[model samples]
Target: MAAQGLSGFYGSVFRRSITVQVLIRTRDHRVLLLRNGNAWELPGGVVKGGEDPRSAARRVARATLDPGSDVGRVLVLDYVQGSQRQGQAQGQGQGDSIAFLFDGGVLSTSVSAFTGAGGEREARFVPLMDWSGGTDEGHGRRWGAAVEALELGTVVELVNGEPASAGPVPAPLPRRMMPPLEGFSGILGH
Candidate 1:
């Protein structure tokens, strides 16, 4: 089985991967997204060994969005089974993954205050209401579901004094291949 292979390879290893989802709200109530070469996805990546999910989220946000900026609270923990590898059956892979979703607000300061690599790409801040109308040409269905959930107002909630709505329960979505190892350079920062 897949578990057997993973354990054998990593010496009793378990599937415990971490991914992050950043929801950046712009001044106009739009959400920021990155075109990951071909597909449009929230700026995120897998967490390294022994790294906290929150730190991983921040690292991803910095790499894809604004570095040196603080990330807000974690909004949700979307769990999914499997690894980024292909040919593995459902529920089979190296580890389990918890997709940590965070909500970020535009800084009242200035863009210059937050800078990092990949900043020149110009991240897209799309209106939430109009997201559903857009085509998911390169993103495929999984990304489509994430986008739909956000547009439906089912992914996040306002954190006031009272408890927030659970929003929409995430449905089962197919796992996509993880980015290559080189793409994760500096993700762990040694």
Candidate 2:
């Protein structure tokens, strides 16, 4: 009985809501923002149980944006503290929430192909300069950091929509040197 109770306690403690958000853009630098009622946000959905973040992002993008959209590398990791007022948001459990933001490479086709493609009620390309007006303050901050990270080819980690005091960035890995050719002889050799 004690063991079962302990397991339940830990299970509840570890339960958290994980969501995947994609940053899709057009050639003109406009971003794709989905309208969820009055709120505007990136195209994505809650990561299903046992589903990897990348896969979830792609899946959500296909369902939310264009089917040909390719989800790229992760750009931002936003961890938000759960609030009682926002109970049972995104998924089960009322614990903290973690959002994975991925780069959804520039759309090559016309924007008309994506708008209302896959049950997405409404979606529009919003200019970067006007992103602040499309979403809430926290979302605006996170999106700004994500855009900066994408431009710098780096990743940004956030805690509650604020940049965490992460230590110095680590140096990139050294390039691998080519191996010497085998069984090669000098042309001047007699």
Candidate 3:
């Protein structure tokens, strides 16, 4: 029936997972990394159904890091295809996942009393230069891209941890030329 077909289509659309990641840094350029099993990851988790991503990000940050932490604009949007685990006999249909990287703002170096949430262990700050060496490769690349986007005040889109497009870099804008007021003078009565 038509209703059955429509329900199936809706179910498929809703199966995609949505995850949120927060990029919190220190003033010394060190990034926060939480130990998840053998891999280091950002402080974030799956976004609940019908939850706003920004709110989810804030919630994750509050749960994982300081409760008073602030969440900023999105830095990266990544679409990743789910892959089967090696040596797993069963094919668990892990559908595609969409991830959002949000700015968790900078933290002070003196603040180190961190208690992780979920499956995470201790949390530490690692220098930006050594992120890839200590964390999951995919997450490392995402961190790098997110950092660049944050610094440039832009948002980047990625597919499978890589830039979706290699578009040309935009040129800097020229200064606006405003005409002088006909009657108004300087505040100093010039």
Candidate 4:
């Protein structure tokens, strides 16, 4: 009993986090890119507990990019194994990551006029072919897959550059189909 307790208490705890990211295009065939410094990442963040990833994509956009934009179907899903910051202090935690890449479609307004509301320093629309930085930061494949998804209007399940799942993704349920909230019965059109 004591041995089991020691093992359980001393073993590393597994942590996992889900993130929702979106790719938004422009009418002129450009993609909206946000820059913080030398590297610019696609828009996304960690999904909150109990919050669905689909809606989380929209919420992330509203918090950063256009506030009223609609998030379309998921473009791609990727799973990255757990990682730790090299040379960090001991006892720091490492966690697995699951990410959903959603198609945010085109921006309703011009991409240039708007500055990023989040920590992003600036926002600009760049042509797909000339997106110089897209190939770096292990983002080339993700960007490619996302653009392909946008073009095909379908979802792809990718596990480390390989398609792991086949077939199209089902459309999201309408508001009526979703279950009503607790304590709000009868008022929500039961």
Best model per lDDT: 3
lDDT (Cα, tens digit) per residue for candidate 1, span 1-190: 9998876667424556667766666665556666667555666778888888778878777776556866776655555444433456754656655566766546332232232354655456666565542344322233444444455654433221111344544678987566547546545655
lDDT of 4 at 160: 49
Which digits, one per residue and each the tens of the lDDT, describe model 4 over residues 63-181?
Answer: 76557877988898887554432344554565556779888787555546356455335777778787654546335676787887777877677664446666665778867855768
- Prediction 2 TM-score vs. true: 0.73
lDDT of each: 0.56, 0.78, 0.79, 0.71
TM-score of each: 0.55, 0.73, 0.73, 0.68
| lDDT comparing candidate 4 with the true structure | 0.71
How much is the lDDT of residue 17 in candidate 1? 63
lDDT of 3 at 125: 83
Give one digit per residue, the lDDT tens place, for model 2 in 106-179: 87545633447556577878777777835466677778888988878988998888887666467899873555
Give the residue spans of candidate 2 off by over 4 A. 1-11, 83-93, 109-120, 170-190
Ranking by TM-score: 3, 2, 4, 1
List the lowest-lDDT window of 10 residues for candidate 1: 156-165
Winner of 1 and 2 under TM-score: 2
The per-candidate count of clashes, in order, stands at 2, 0, 0, 0
By lDDT, the better pick of 3 and 4 is 3
